[model samples]
Target: MNDSVNRPADGAPISVVLAGGGTAGHVEPAMAVADALTALHPDVRITALGTARGLETRLVPERGYHLELITPVPLPRKPTGDLVRLPGRVRRAVRQTRHVFDDVAVDVVIGFGGYVALPAYLAARGGVRRRRVPVVIHEANATAGIANKVGARSAQRVLSAVPGSGLKDAEVIGVPVRAAITALDRAAQRAEARAAFGLPDDTPVLLVFGGSQGAASINRAVSAAAGELARSGVAVLHAYGAKNTLDLRTPEPGDPPYVAVPYLNRMDLAYAAADLAICRSGAMTVAEVSAVGLPAVYVPLPIGNGEQRLNALPVVNAGGGLLVDDADLTPRFVAEVADALLTDPPRLSAMTSAAAQVGHRDAAERVAAVALDIALSGRAARGRRR
Candidate 1:
């Protein structure tokens, strides 16, 4: 699919091409950066390149941006018979993106690390010979994913969500969180938020979420430990994800004093209401937790070459949260960590301070500034040539 138009002439609207998909982790950052650009430079035109197979087809358009679909083939983790098809798919995606660049006259390409992002990076480097459009990549996870690894060599600037990933030209700008999360006033909203979420005014609440889709291992462990946590005077708000809720038998009546929901549409309220959090260490999750200054116990997903562990390391090291491996996650362990964090006021306060320290709540604005600069610089160079 191709979505294209001439760049607006008002200050020569920087035509930005964002490529990433497959999950909310990848797509959300791209949107955050796009929103940042729109806020900083109203004339800047943003378009997204993604595959229909990924979540972008739904998410990008839903966010009021143009979505361009391209054919994407999964890269093999290990060499297999399907490996031969990889080259052909890559060629097709590259060709499609080339057409997209030509149609849109894209000035810069920003990639947020995913297989769907590869074509746009290749097109920016190989197909657009005249403009030399700047390519920027943001790696949101600790261990760089395969897409970012390939995109890095050609990227003009690399921005990392976590620090010291051994990537050159990398800046630790923190992951871009949604605008709503950044706008919250923790001290001002805490009391009212607690009441809104149906928790006692003074009860210490622990917010638990696996992710948008949720993690079964985390959900199971937290459910089993709910009673223990409640007995310690900690209230629980758990989002079990829609898919996992069916298999999770309901707690017996009058058991754990907690609220269980499949999803949370109002994360601002949830964050404001919580005293602490237990969550997966996805890049977006880390940013949101840090943005809101909530102490956390992070359980990184045990998959994809331990990428989640790498994402959580910075926050864990900074004393913002504790990282526990999935192998180590158990009902007893979950209860113990939750109890300790919620009950210890001094420790919880320290963690919140540390989290706030590392969080760059204005990262989206910074990213947008870079995008606008690249676009304006490209335009100036073109004018000089003419």
Candidate 2:
């Protein structure tokens, strides 16, 4: 895929459009690569394509990247009325996306499979009057989603978080996580991290959280066991969802602090403060937790195509962590499993080492390099055609 293509002239500016909006799982990876590209080539311009309904409406702007809004064409799971209208919805989104490409003079398109991606892919393949741009696809799930599967057909390069993602011959580059997570040193920052949360310095700490909005089942189960865990001298730093509530008996002066917050703005410090975690096994969550070498009892959400379970499988199989079913993650289960791991430092240490080994800390830079190459090559190809 890297066969020598024409190279853009020295100091020439390059532009890229990233199409991976909707959820944090898709947006975070896209942002990480965008950051990498900026760090590597200050002259590079980046734009993000997203729908108004997705998290990107806020997250993209918050990250200081320009976001272009497009009409969302949500694919219905069943043969509903929405499915019947899919073609026209797709046409409108594709048209809007093509306008963004023309306005930006986009050198290349890098997509992390989602509702916005299919339109972007089709737009990149310009019509008879327009020039087609190179396309790159990154599948961040264990199984390739429909949009990614379709994009891969014409993609110049295809990447995956794991093998067997159903995008045949795709390169395996672990999920792209921000430098903050990839560079975190849990052991070295443990003291300061604990102090930040008011957690005790000498006790085992268990961190509990759901995704951004929070998981109700996880909140109920973990909060129910909070008191029992505190009595056993285990400190808790729980980021209960901003939308969820936790009822807890106030800790006495001697009891290890149970610092409950609505959200965790500093996940690096959170990872540093805890020896283990009980959280949902979303793709980004797995990448971040495992990247920091923090052992976790991953509880995959019971819904969806079971992709969450697949996301954590390699880590669990590598002995870096354990996986428990959502239905089995009761209050008692949390208490027992957490106590067993926290009390056994040797086991925890082994698990930590395994987790770190499986984490591809350089994944962001690796993907960024390939994406930049594709952009430059496309520029080169265009120049030659001229």
Candidate 3:
């Protein structure tokens, strides 16, 4: 009766397939848990399932994991031609996923609720000649997406970042963020991080960015306030979308510098360098920002079912962050609120503690531990059947 999930009863290495791709929101949590699984058992086999069209094509391989691409089955929200063809697309994707499952001898399927997860869930549930495997689901959004809502039915374990993600029985495990984020020492790294970003060490820095592609509204508002912020002794690091351009003026010799980059590869450094952040409140963003203990003014994307607002509200209510509607995020608002906060050390320090309190730093390891246990149990059950 060994309690270790690192090895099965037969001493075979556990194989896991993570299905969460398309968006950074889905892909990041999956990767975080994948990293955690490997850290727990170095010999464990980990694979990622994604489509050619998703960011996982780049993100998965860069993290040094094997990626299997399958036909994407997009769920249409309304009655359309795509909806009519949904069944056939799902069948094809499921068939392709089943092949990957067999190739890897996957013992467990861990899904993060995206276009890539449904087929993997169905394939693992057993159909036709498919073999059944344990399924674990992690829903990272405040509102569960279509794929996760379906996958939750037969999952061996269901997890979510928040309580009301539409997964009624989901265990609240928090969103899984990378270890680099959870282990960050912002105070210790601040000097090096500011230097890395070509920023002044003594200035209060405001880190602003949308998602990977950047947010147009956020970009416009933040960039427009660059002059006012710099004049007020606040340095600005703005990551406008790659495709978008800003019309900000060059800083005067005595003013705090305004640094604008298209993207941020080292978020750990960015978090270390900033006193305050103005950004979108995606589940992943909220989790990462709070995990690093960085205070933020979260501007929810004004679309969908107000899920982004819901994502930020708990943290905001806890005094870890602020919630600003997209429509209200103008230059004047940035000057009055963001500028005032950046200058207030007492408020920022209080918010930092509150944000850290809301973040689950061990979420990845918790998910990995449970997933491994489920995998081991499945393997032992199969052994008994033989």
Candidate 4:
């Protein structure tokens, strides 16, 4: 795709573009791969492609990457008023993204699958510009998103964060998680992790959370059952999300302590302190806990194509986690199931090993290496053509 001089000045950096963003689920993986690329190839020039309206607008820059902004053009799942305008909107986004690719002389384009990714994939495939480049796509959801489904056919390689992602022949590489989590050693940091969260060193701790805004059902159920868990000598570390508030279950004189917070920016500490988790089965959440070898009770969001259930199924099947329907995750269920598992050290230990076995701590590095290799191959092809 580089139509300029046959080669750059000696020692010039190899350029790579990462595309995706909307939620932290998409952004974090892109950033993790960026981090891996920077670490592994010091001479690499990293560029992020995302929409102005996505989390990447702020997060990518904050992480020290140059983010190229484009307009967001969301596709309607069904025929709607938005469908009439989609063609023009998508065309405009593709043009903008194509400009970015040409401007950067991109050697390869890697997409993590989101609204922005569709345009990046198109641009990398040459689109109206007639400048083809190698394309790599990563699907982080258990079910492939529309962008990934469309992009995978044209990609040089397809990667999935979880099993059963519905992408044909896609390699299961796990999610590219935050380095903090992949490096966490719960066994080594157990005491320090508990102390960091003001948790008792000797008691079993159960961690509960939903998504970022918090799941109202989880909050209500877990908050109501906190007193029961405390009475059973089990402590709690609950993240109520920034938008929701927990009706605190006041600890009595002889009860185990309960810690509640509006948000947990330091999930590393939470994962380290937790003996088990009761949380949603978002791809990132599943990947992180599985990487750290933490057992969990997953309550998938009852909305959208039922992908969350698919996300937790592999772990649950592997004996590393349990998937409970959202409607069934009541206070009684939490107590009976979560408590039963937490109290059984032998079961938890086996589950821990099972989870670790399925997780990939080096996923970021592995994905980065794949992208970099394609970039190198693309350059070599260009050299031969010259």
What residue runs in model 4 are displaced by over 4 Å at the alpha carbon? 1-10, 127-129
TM-score of 4: 0.95
Model 3 stretches with alpha carbons more than 4 Å out:
1-3
**Candidate 1 lDDT, tens digit per residue, 1-386?**
00111343344557899887888999999998888878776667788988878888888988899988888857788888768889999999888988888788898988887867888787787533544568888888877777888888988789988776657779989888779888888878888887777878777888989999988998888888876876777778888898877233455564444888899988899999898888998889988888888888899888777878888777788999899988789989988988877779999999999988877798777776776676666676677778
Ranking by lDDT: 3, 2, 4, 1
Candidate 4 local lDDT, residue 145? 89
Off by over 4 Å in 2: 1-7
lDDT comparing candidate 4 with the true structure: 0.86
Q: Highest lDDT: which candidate?
A: 3
* Residue pairs whose backbone atoms clash in candidate 4: none
Task: Please report how far candidate 2 places residue 291 from its true position, in Å.
Answer: 0.8
Please provide, for model 3 over 1-386, each residue's C-alpha lDDT reduced to its tens digit, 9 standing for 90 to 100: 23576556787778999999899999999999999999988889999999999999999999999999998888999999999999999999998999899899899999998888999989989966666788999999899998998999999899999888888689998999999999999999999999999999999999999989899999888888877887788998888879888789777889888889989999999999999999999999999999998999999989988899999988999999998899999998997887789878999999999999999899999899988888887777788899
Worst 10 residues of 4 by lDDT: 1-10
After superposing candidate 1 on the true structure, give the runs of residues whose Cα lies further than 4 Å from its correct spot.
1-12, 127-131, 246-256
User: TM-score for all predictions?
Assistant: 0.92, 0.96, 0.98, 0.95
Q: lDDT tens string, model 4, 1-386?
A: 22222234344577888988788889999999999988877768888988878889888999999998887878789999899998888899899988888788788888998778888887777745386888889988989988998989989999988767888889999999879999999989889889988889999999998977789999999888877787678999999888887897557897877888988988998999999999999988888989999999999999999989988888889999988999998888878876798889999999999999888798898888888777777676777888
RMSD of each: 4.0, 2.0, 1.3, 3.2
